[model samples]
Target: MLILKLTNITKEYNSRVILNDINLSCKNCEMIAIKGKSGVGKSTLLNIMAGLERATSGEYYYNEILMNDKSINSLSKFRQANVGYISQHSPMIPELTVLENICVPVWFEKDEEKKKEYMQQIESLSMLFEINNLLDKKINALSGGEIQRAGIIRSILKKPQLIIADEPTAALDDETALMILTHFNFLKSEGAIIIVVTHNDIVSKHCDKTYQLSKEGLLLIS
Candidate 1:
């Protein structure tokens, strides 16, 4: 099964140690939560997991491949092929329609088969997030919760093996947040690994496992 393992992962900036000797592991079809107080480097750790940043020391393995020493280009390719990220605000281009922003990543697929798959995913995910009707609206016209739902569809459009979400339901109300969590469980059942970094108890309580991040490292608190 798809496996992600981090061993002795460490990060430093200038002279500050953000993550120190952290270790974590996750397998397919699992939804995990990472919780921590502000300034505890939760986002930094997510960056490393999403390949947006590299750990200064230690190894990161996906399945059986070692990613610690891969070139920047290779890492970029890896992210494109295997990682999906849902950010706090669900970054979108203000000028683009929700549909356009969601399709930006796979708008020009060379493979007809792949294109069809993405199209189907968009349709299905839009329904799941209940955002199909908002597709025609410009990003600037949508509310925070609506934008967050659209962002979720965009992030998973490619069906990446690893899904990295940072406070995905922060802007959503309780109902919408539960809807998001339900879909996360659905994704897990479909064999995708979901890593969520959130401080929301409702969100954390829904995950299969929970870990707390600190300067000391990552620890399983539940």
Candidate 2:
């Protein structure tokens, strides 16, 4: 099934075009890597899909529903419930404990039983990410890699249908980057649509397919 579709999408800043007539679609269980040089609008594309940024032209569809300005509230709810985003820098609260941070999104669910179920899932994900030890630790006390793993755990804890990552491995060393990418691969196998915006060649090589962004537009690189 098509999980996301972007048709003739364009983004401009002060009349300067960043993305031009880009079209793409992602299927369920697909792992797509978006690669390009610095400042090539890779992150812009991901942000637009995630509803963090608005497209200047064209349309974005998630699960066959058109996403537009009037659907802002619906988009926000969909993102919080069905999409998980991991940016270059992990957005962890300095004062919150790792477990607390992971469970923060759970409060959005009003169902008491479902909220408790999600908390249990979070604990399992923390263990899977090897972050169980850090659950009680404040975010500020974690090392770079620890925080990054926590971020991944937090994203997956919600069992999102789509996972969008922007240079998620940029702060990690070679081995750690490979490990994180491997985890993403595993998630893809379990039926999540994973889209990663990365400049890393290793990540591109491991992805199911790759797209490159340039001044002209988005092109298939692999």
Candidate 3:
């Protein structure tokens, strides 16, 4: 089923156009990579999809609901419930331990039973990602790859319907990046819309489809 659709989306800064007349449609169980050189608006496109930024013009629909007109509070609630965003930068909070940082997404759950269930899932995910040993350590203690893997685990623990990952494997070595991409494939099979923004060929190659962003807009490369 189609989970996301964008029509003639345009984003600009002052007089500078970053993305112009872009159109995209994504379905469940699909992995899409947005690729571009450093100055292109790959990250900006992901941010806009994640509702962290707004386009100057055009339409965005999530699950057939119009997101362009949704209130900030409404969008925030939607994102909290259905969207998992792994940003380009480390998502870890310095004050929180590794486990605590991973649990942040479910922290607001008021239902005791659901919260307990989420915690159990978190533990399982940590073990799968091989981060169980570092759960008690501080965020500062883990290596970059460890932190990125943990961040990915955190994002997926909630089993969000749409996962927007920005440069998720940007800093990892080949082995680690492949490991993360494998997990992303698993998520895709489980019916999640995985959108990754990256410059890496390995990351893009693993995705089901790749789109390139330029001043003119998004173009399908695969």
* Best lDDT among the predictions, by candidate number: 1
User: What total of clashing residue pairs does each candidate reach?
Assistant: 0, 0, 0
Q: Quote the positional error of residue 108 for candidate 2 in Å.
A: 2.0
Highest TM-score: give the candidate number. Answer: 1
Off by over 4 Å in 1: none
Ranking by TM-score: 1, 3, 2
| Candidate 2, superposed: residue stretches over 4 Å from native | none
Ranking by lDDT: 1, 3, 2
Q: Least accurate stretch of 10 residues (summed lDDT) in model 3?
A: 83-92
lDDT of 2 by residue, 43-79 (tens): 8888898877889999888889888563678778878
lDDT of 1 by residue, 1-222 (tens): 889999999899997888899999999999999999999999998888888898899998888898888899998989999888999888889999999899988876789899889989999899888889889998888889999998888888898889999988888899999998898888789899999999899999988899999877899999
RMSD of 2: 1.5
What are the lDDT figures for the candidates, one per model?
0.90, 0.85, 0.87
Better by lDDT, candidate 3 or 2: 3
Q: Show the lowest summed lDDT stretch of 10 residues, model 2.
A: 66-75
Q: Per-residue error at 55 for model 1, in Å?
A: 0.5
> How far is each candidate from the true structure, as Cα RMSD in Å?
1.1, 1.5, 1.3
TM-score of each: 0.96, 0.94, 0.95
Q: Counting only residues 3 or more apart in sequence or on different chains, how many pairs clash (N, Cα, C under 3 Å) in candidate 3? A: 0
Pairs in clash, predicted candidate 3 = none
